[model samples]
Target: MFKDITPNQLFDLKQSKMTIVDVRSPKEFQDATIPGAINMPLFSDEERSVIGTIYKLEGQEAAKDLGLKICAKKLPEYIEAFKQLPQPLTVFCWRGGMRSKTVATVLDLMNIHVTKLSGGIKAYRNWIKEQLDTLPLPELFVLNGCTGSGKTHMLHTLEKEGYPVIELERMASHRGSIFGHIGRKPLNQRTFDLVLGEALLTLKNAPYIVIEGESSRIGKIKIPDRFYQHKEASHQYVIALPIAQRIELILAEYQPEIHHDQFIEAFSIIKRRIHTPVAHRIDEALKNHNYREAIRDLLDYYYDPRYRHTLNYNEEQMTTFKVTSIEDALAKLRAILPALHVF
Candidate 1:
């Protein structure tokens, strides 16, 4: 059912110009799959649904008959699609099931040198699950501090210096909080995974990496569990600054025009948990130019309370380190990430 390529061999071929095909239906392909995989479904969503219903209501034999009919119809179209990628080709479906095997077998007969994923998409997803679960989390050094601490500004500074810093919230089109979304379309999940894959690829041999402290879900996208908990449990570093500097940082992050009722739409996600007094205070502050009061009050009533509740009750024990000044943060970081200081 497979080319008998070793994991390394298949993986090696996967790196460059190779054709990876997903034989699952369009809906499944849209949900998630390996990068660069083209959708050449052996069954469309409705076709698969009908076949499944027959299997449940009639019998396995009847379902197989229905599946064969769908496959025969699409077989030629499927072949044509693979023509676009002339290089080594591979095919996979949910469980290395009949659909993938059939397509793979057809291509193999044509002398395409095709490989079928051993366990199929199930295996790849399982691999992600395992890495997210058991792989000792990456060494996650965080850029943490209060609002004006310029944590994000520092991330850019570090990036310019050549350090690998993950601007996760920025990529997610969210600020990693309730009022995070500014309505731009977040990156598609496929692109998101591609970026994440690249980041993970870069960190493979590193001792540690610096990332911003973020909640599990940024806007609507959730971080993989393994990385989140790893950072949560790892040594934490705080990027600190004076109050005046922090205020400036705050203003820079959330702009004046953005302070209007439109944020209410985003914050609506947490309305149930928002206290009545806090809501009233926010409304009043929004009406007046009491932006400082509005922001601080929200932090005290909503943000601070929630963060405290999480930090205090969470089972993952974390060690704290402070970034007293930009120079100090850079100095401490330089010791661990020497190449980062080059910029």
Candidate 2:
């Protein structure tokens, strides 16, 4: 018999060599899933839709019969896939129901030691939510800068130098702006929570953490209220750089990922702030593959204007680093932090 393991047990399994298999539909796996689980979906999206329709109109028995028929031919393939995996493995479906059980049973009969998640991905999700809700976050230090100031680059530099940092943009899969959606799709809320929970758990013992300043929302995901409140009240370092240098940095970071249509779409977000003629000029620049001109124009006319007026940093909680180069900026920050006591 396959071992029936709880969600807590799944966490323990994660620390071992066992591979976590998600047997839900691929679409379901994509929307949200256990953080390190690999998708080995028992049903494709279309198959799931068909099964759902059958279940709704013809009832459970008919749906089960059809599902069995659909899956019967795939048994050899399933066995081959499972055989390739190490003997000790774990599996789950949406609710730890038939799909995972069938796989686990088949494997167990083949003398493959398989563990089935008792409550499935749903249980793991609940565990993640609870962990996030009660998460003990480190003392957060937000790194603030205007658009094009190379804040993310600075964070990466700090991380390489052994500073404790959690990149909110990486976790959310968006860079935290209108154009942030470029190059990556936003993770759904549940998936975001799982990633965030894992990050917080890893950093719980750190004395302090460096993070980027962000609004309550990053792309489609909302920051947890507690974490956001902590960021709002915590100390912050502001990085200021020459506008020309900033534009160069911004252009370098986004240029590779920019598509003509995407560049146009991003600028269109600020159409209300730009004169129609200026907007047309930006559009023409995009069409001509002159993204630098469009980037500079948008930053000057749109991002800078909006950001400059909105920043209301408290003198007591903020430190400013003004420099012409990234190295100078980082040096200033390093000098400000206590070598032994700071993270």
User: Could you report the Cα RMSD, in angstroms, for every candidate shown?
Assistant: 5.4, 2.5
**Best candidate (score: TM-score):** 2
- Give the per-residue lDDT of model 2 (tens digit) for 295-317: 77877777877777756768999
The alpha-carbon lDDT assigned to residue 7 of candidate 1 equals 29
Judged by whole-model lDDT over C-alpha atoms, candidate 2 comes out at 0.83
What does the lDDT read for residue 78 in candidate 2? 83
Number of clashes recorded per candidate: 2, 0
lDDT of each: 0.68, 0.83
Stretches of model 1 off by over 4 angstroms after superposition: 1-13, 132-138, 147-175, 181-202, 215-229, 241-262, 269-278, 284-297, 304-336, 340-343
TM-scores for candidates 1 onward, in order: 0.70, 0.90
TM-score between model 2 and native: 0.90
Cand. 1 TM to true fold: 0.70
Name the lDDT value of residue 28 in candidate 2: 90
**Which residue pairs show backbone clashes in model 2?**
none
